[model samples]
Target: MIISHKNILVSGKHQKSIVTDVFYTNEIVQKPVVIFCHGYKGFKDWGAWDLVANAFAKAGFFFVKFNFSYNGGTVEQPIDFSDLDAFGHNNYIKELDDVESVLDWITTTHTEYTDFIDTTKITLIGHSRGGGIVLIKAAEDARVQKLITWASVSDYKNRFPKGADFEKWENSGVYYVKNGRTKQEMPHYFQFYTSFIENKERLTISRAAKKIKIPHLIIHGSEDPTVSIEEAQKLHAWNRNSHMLIVKEADHVFGTKHPWSQQYLPNALQKIITESVSFAIF
Candidate 1:
């Protein structure tokens, strides 16, 4: 199997461009498409994601991964958090718009690859916050045929600061979140909360998951400290028809850390890719 890669930029909401990567092979005709959405502070080049994309491509599917327009990564620097201002202005609604914008590009501007892709069989795979965005998109968008989330959050409400931190945020107009791995100061503007209030129903992941008429897979880590396993159970309860898998020892990132330099995929991360690809094809 000859795996091919393409890096493209798609125009997104708020005049920003979403930097994306396309992985596929010319071996098959009309292969399925899987769009991967990175979570908070995550970019297309994070950790072993490139290897993960290659695994999916080798599994007979066209894989697409992209950095959200306001995900703090610029086209020139797609690996690090270089655009703090854009990150501060990001909101759930804008993320939804970003995913839709990518879909529009794949279905329209990227038609040149129609011979190698089956547009009707689009599947979305999101990790963490990206998972929530994909859940909402799957419910609202008719083009999404299947959905999958890894270490996903159950809700986006109340994720902002609280108490003294909340007070500081209200007074300062922006709150800073420290990225433990990069040690970079990330900003979350007050508009992030206002946008949630403005589009409460539209941004509700649980509500959107309940309305999904297609197959859905919920993958969570039992030892995940960032998002408890209970969140996955809650997602399964809301969407009982959806399948759920709890990897016993996996962490928030399934044992894959940033700056991962190994040529081989970590065991836990490989398992995640296997399950995701299996569910996607099933």
Candidate 2:
């Protein structure tokens, strides 16, 4: 039977709490650990991620997924954007530190789950913006044994605004982007760009990808409009040893969407999950 520990708070970045969830089976048997990081504007319970976590648990792996403390979600509310202020203040350094805190929590603080976790075989999986986070984490931390990225961005600096728009953001201090699903105006403080600049070398996804010596799998949807397939190609090019897969018609979310209500995963997402499982196992 799969056991799930939901809505647990893990201390992270500046004492803020990271809302975390863990899924696993067989309490007595040690299983490979998989830590998943959600993307920009994403939470631990977004869409079919719970299903994905259960899939990993059923496969005899200790799976963990968490909100990045500043992803706009609070400890009381782990889904959707609740605190736009925190979200606006978020930066790459905070996210990287959050991942480290989760790793520390699982390996040291959470002794109760130690029996079911294999710390030495930890794998980091990230989706979209998360893919970039995991890549940098995996490169810097020796604790991670394997790495996987789903629909990841190859560059971060390029994602930032340039020229006049950049000047406008600098002058205004914060810029807003309307969340299509939530229809909420999301704010990005100019400090976000400054933070990235402060850690530019460390936050470079391509640099981290090249530095990774562990097995890495890169998966992307060919039709993903949010992040193009060429980004995956760039990742593959940077890491000659890494494996890449282009899902024929899958989109950024792998055919899954917010508030996914179906009992089963979308075909494309299922295929990605199967591939990820195989990659994690072998």
Candidate 3:
């Protein structure tokens, strides 16, 4: 297995955006491709991801995981919240564009896996918020053959606080949410809401899921606090063809943190990978 990390410059809202990718290459030609998108406040190099990528590569798949362009990480610093400005400016539409750009890169620019990856056989795997983005993308893009979401949110509108004065928020221009662990106040500009409202028709997960005619898998932890298992059920319910799997006792992040310590796989995460592998291959 040959694993390499590279920086990619992607076209974005204003200027070129930098994204990092972890590519797993094998000698075999025309292998199925698994493109992974990280969750909110997550990076490609987050805990256990390297091991997960290796696992997929070992399973005879060409795996690629990348950072969303505005995921708060820069080319110089690929981990942690070093660029809050970028994070603040991020929105769902931009993420969808980023994924499209990555797909374009995979189809046109990247040469290392040119012969190894079958662009038509691409599968997208998204974790948490990334899952919502993938669902939207898969519905619109015909290139995606399979879709998988782990602990994903069914609705993007639910992310914002309810019963708020829209006029005040529009006037204030920004709202802040406290990151309990980091103790940092993350700001959401009014543009975020405006963007969603403008793209509401295109961003609806249920709407997208209903249009998806390909294989779809929804996996979530029964004990997930961040995104309840019910949300997973909702996603499955939206798509008649989707398969839903709930881990017995796993919580959000599958019992892993930003700085995960254990060298071995957590039972819950291992189960997710195993199930996903089966879904992707079958």
* Candidate 1: pairs in clash: none
User: lDDT scores for all predictions?
Assistant: 0.89, 0.93, 0.84
Query: Which should have the higher lDDT, number 1 or number 2?
Result: 2
Instruction: Please give each candidate's TM-score.
Output: 0.97, 0.98, 0.94
Over 1-282, each residue of candidate 3 has an lDDT whose tens digit, in order, gives 576666655555545474756556657667788999999888888998877887787777888887887887887787777878878888998899988988888778778667787877899999999999999999999989999999999898878756665666677887777777777777778888989999999998889988989999999998999997888988888887789998999998887877776687889999999999989983
Better of 2 and 3 by lDDT: 2
lDDT per residue (tens digit) for residues 1-282 in model 1:
656554588998779889999888767598899999999889889999999989998998989999999999888888888889999999988889999999998888887688888899999999999999999999988999999999999899858778999899989999998999888889999999988989998887789888988999999988999998988998999988999989989999999888989999977888888999988884
Off by over 4 Å in 2: none
- Model 2 lDDT per residue over 8-29, tens place: 9888857799899999996688
Best by TM-score: 2
**Model 3 quality (TM-score):** 0.94
Which candidate has the top score in lDDT? 2
Backbone clash count, each prediction separately: 0, 0, 0
Give the Cα error of residue 43 in candidate 3, in Å: 1.5
Instruction: Give per-model CA RMSD.
Output: 1.2, 0.8, 1.7
Candidate 1 Cα misplacement greater than 4 A, ranges: none
- Rank list by lDDT: 2, 1, 3
